[model samples]
Target: MSTNRQLVSVDYEIFGNVQGVCFRMYTEDHGKKLGVVGWVMNTREGSVKGQVQGPADKVDEMKQWLRTTGSPSSRIDRAEFSNQRDVPDLELRGFSTRYH
Candidate 1:
């Protein structure tokens, strides 16, 4: 067992009308506001994908935001998350929007 499993990481993809609607922008803002570290980018397949790492509660809040609320002009069909695990420390620093 390890200590400080309080940190967790997760990968997420938001589907439907996400692109071209500033989804990444809002995600970045919300992530930063939540004090989570990760990156969000627009996928080639027309979805938004990213990784988030932080305290479990913060991550959960981010997940909820990703699932239910996005940009004002965006319509979310669903959100899919994967690769969830507890980490001893955060692997990333600060939240931002990835260009690539």
Candidate 2:
């Protein structure tokens, strides 16, 4: 379906108080709800890294949620968004949390 409305993908890295806060679970749930596909995992540097692909609007909304209201207990200091690009189709089937 190569419609005029192209989907977008963004890579983000979250910092601060994310590790023991169920951030990945919450992110998965949110991504599923938003119909975005990508993978999220905890980095060795104590940060959350993932890529989200979906409708441009929804992706933007997800970014907002990730940066502002991540899991109930997460205190997100900042969300760095990068590699934003347009995609012809969804490369992911569903959102999932990756263990790393």
Candidate 3:
């Protein structure tokens, strides 16, 4: 029996007409469907900040989808990722609109 789990954390900033176009909503919906756990919000600087954590491969797939198909009529400037050691232990129930 093997009990090894692989998890990863991804942070991305999507830009260019992303706000007001239902980008966050779309991201949240898709992320949930992909079994991702994290938050997505619009930054004051006209960008979307998102953090997703899950299986390594699933996380990567979600990132790719966000960069390509997940973007709703918006231009994705960049998507960055890093290996995180300390991740919060919380379950993402659903995606919401955040004003900040």
TM-score of each: 0.93, 0.93, 0.76
lDDT of 2 by residue, 14-72 (tens): 99999999999999999999778888999999999999999888898899999899999
lDDT for model 1: 0.93
On a 0 to 100 scale, what is the lDDT of residue 80 in model 3?
57
Q: Give the per-residue Cα lDDT of candidate 2 at 32.
A: 90
Please give the distance, in angstroms, between residue 74's alpha carbon in candidate 2 and its true position after superposition.
Answer: 0.6
Q: Per-residue CA lDDT of candidate 1, range 1-100, in tens?
A: 3333489999999999999998999999999999999999998999999999998888999999999989999999999999999888889989989987
Off by over 4 Å in 1: 1-5
Highest lDDT, which number?
1
Candidate 2: C-alpha RMSD to true structure equals 2.1
Tell me the whole-model lDDT of each prediction, alpha carbons only. 0.93, 0.91, 0.70
lDDT of 3 by residue, 24-89 (tens): 888888878878677789899888887787766667778888777755577776665654543444
Candidate 3 TM-score over all chains jointly: 0.76
lDDT for predicted candidate 2 compared with the true structure: 0.91
**Model 1 compared with the native: what TM-score?**
0.93
Candidate structures ordered by TM-score, highest first: 1, 2, 3
